[model samples]
Target: MATRNIYYKSKTGILHWLGLAIAIVLLDQISKIWISHILHYGQAIRITSFFNLILVYNEGAAFSFLASQSGWQRYFFTAISILAVVVIVYLLKKHAHQRLFCLSLALILGGAIGNLIDRSLYGHVIDFLDVHAMGWHWPTFNIADCGITIGAVLFIIDELKRVRKS
Candidate 1:
């Protein structure tokens, strides 16, 4: 079964994880604010051969999905983010004792709140930290994206390990 009951063995505190989430949110917001102040839109400052500190605004989901929509995507995505945050919080409380699972959920919760704050305040998410190479460019992203991505990966890896043991 793919249930979450497998992680009732270990006991990890929830407050620390929540604190980490809050710290992530603060860092993400501060970085976005600093970059927004330093660079205008469409400004790219090359930091390396394949990396840049660019300022870009995302009005859509990951990789600019649904970006060209007729202004409705903003509310849609905001609602989705809010819903995800709520669900993630519930999971965190229920599985707070599961260290890896809680860690992943906390990171995800932080990332969601970070992006959600942007979506509420700016009507879009401000993204910097551009990476490109070999004449190819990946989508510009920010700290929140990094947290969400790493958290998701860790979640998958933990689930895999649990499944293997069972």
Candidate 2:
């Protein structure tokens, strides 16, 4: 017998998930643009004991990997984001009825597209949110990063549930 798709069928339209992705991209872009306008590069404003608003750019993947390279990293990351977007879109289209899985994919898709837009326009990704601790600062990130991180966690959870059910 052919193996069946493990996810439950749903009535949710793929368009709805795509809408969510578009909303995320809009919010991320708007926030980044606003931050860029309000804060000079490398500027930071303390928002709380452990939080900050800042404006910075990343030319590489997470944690500044390859950031020291001579500008080649920008196009490299852009290509990677494009590939990820294509894969995510394909999965989203194929699994539109899987609510949770599709939701996770939509989040990742939005994030990839958001950073892709940044790479295309600025050759870097805009990062603002800064979380810190006692004399230690985590790498600054942005809304797109949040979406991608949350989506990854949710994707893992959904997959674990699916595996357990099988």
User: For residues 23-134, could you state the per-residue lDDT of candidate 1 as single tens digits?
Assistant: 9999999999999999999998988999999898999989989988898999999999999988888888777888888888888889989999998999889999899989
- How many residue pairs clash per model? 0, 0
TM-scores for every predicted model = 0.91, 0.91
Residue 109 shift from truth in candidate 1, angstroms: 0.8
Error of 2 at 57 (Å): 0.7
Top model number, lDDT? 2
Q: Which run of 10 residues does model 1 get worst, by summed lDDT?
A: 6-15
What's the CA error at residue 21 for candidate 2, in Å?
A: 0.7
lDDT of model 1 at residue 47? 86
Clashing pairs in 1: none
Residue 42 C-alpha lDDT in model 1: 96
Report lDDT per candidate.
Answer: 0.90, 0.90
* Prediction 2 TM-score vs. true: 0.91
